[model samples]
Target: MVKINILYASTEGNTTSFVTKLTDIAAENGDIVVARCIGEETDYANETAPFVAIVPTYLTGGTGTGPEVTEIFTNALGDYIAFGRNRQYLKGVIGSGNRNFNVQFNLTATRYAQRFNVPMLFAYELRGSKFDAEKAYHIIKPLFGE
Candidate 1:
């Protein structure tokens, strides 16, 4: 059984919803030993199993304020990802983005991915800002290679 840990840091629950579908897909295949969803607990120390971190990006328009998950995200990176010191782990990071706000978030995701050198996947919103659970699952289903 392949254990999959899905960690999320969501501002408006957009990413949270996306991660849920990913977990569902993992379960449907019956290959997942365990699929857990966590929020504000990205710290690697808190994670006992090999896991994947999925960060969702929300769209910000003029006079729009974005959600904040930096503290949780950075803490996890410091513990699990070897950015400065020398360390390595099997981890995957996937980021989801809104229509127009994706560019900035994509850059942020890439920076983090490059720093950690972990497998990274970025999913951009095809049409809308709010992600449909079922649609999201189908969109990312093929990416799991399952």
Candidate 2:
């Protein structure tokens, strides 16, 4: 069976909802998805399989139109991946955001991919529509190779 590992962080339930749909879709299609959501406590796993990370954008300072997209709102995912062991297993990144945020949209995912030297694989707006979930599922499925 095709298998994938999904590591993600969500605030305000949007990213969690998206990952849940992605996981459910994988199961429906007879694929395997081992998914984990970061929480208030730092959780690290010795991930043996390749994994993709998903994060939503939360930037501090300035409106989208301004030049001051300064900081990421949370460091939880950063710390989770910073476990040193975890970074090697990361395969790619997906992100969620409000398009209205402009340059800051999906900023966390983009930065994570860059920092970890992985591909910026996919992105969806906010919680993502069912169509977006299906699209993400297809994109991820191919990565596992039948």
Candidate 3:
């Protein structure tokens, strides 16, 4: 089975719940899934599995971002990339945001994907729906050669 590492950051628990469902789905698909919340753990550079990040957008006007979450990932992965470590691991991202934010919606995922040169697999509004979880699974499964 392929191993998948998920790093998540949640402000009000919505992103956490959404990631939990996605983790269950990934597990059901026979992939080994390991998850860590940003503040709870610091090091992501040692992860040997393909990486996935689930984060929520905290939009400050038009500048959409997840400051702490992004910083954690950036610090770890930036060093890894600079040192040419874990270069073969595939990376994926998912973002949660309020639709009322308009153009800023899901911008966190977008920015992260660009930074890492990975794909933004899915972007969900608020807590996300059942359909969004399923779609995320489908997108992620194939990356594991499932």
TM-score of each: 0.57, 0.88, 0.75
TM-score of 1: 0.57
Model 3 scores worst on lDDT over the 10 consecutive residues at 68-77
Q: Model 1: how far is 54 from its true place, Å? A: 0.7
After superposition of all CA atoms, the RMSD between model 3 and the true structure is: 4.3
Q: How much is 8 displaced in model 1, in angstroms?
A: 1.9
Question: Candidate 2: which stretches are off by over 4 Å?
Answer: 64-73
Residue-level lDDT of model 2, residues 1-146, one tens digit each, is 78888888887899889988888888898988888887558556576777888888888777762447654645778778878698998878899899987777888788888889989889999999888988998887877777
Ranking by lDDT: 2, 3, 1
Considering TM-score, where higher is better, how would the candidates rank from best to worst?
2, 3, 1
Top lDDT: which candidate number? Answer: 2
RMSD of each: 6.2, 2.2, 4.3
TM-score of candidate 3 versus the correct structure, residues matched by position: 0.75
| Whole-model alpha-carbon lDDT for candidate 2 | 0.82
Instruction: Determine the backbone clash count of candidate 2.
Output: 0
Cα lDDT listed for each candidate:
0.48, 0.82, 0.69
lDDT per residue for candidate 1 within 1-146, as digits (tens), equals 34555555566666655665555665676644243434345433444445555555433343233334332333443344443332343365666565565245444345456667876655545222334544444444443445
Across residues 1-146, which tens digit of lDDT does each residue of candidate 3 receive?
76667777776889878877887777787776677776434454545667677778764433434453334223443344333455346477788888887767877778767877888888999988877988887877677665
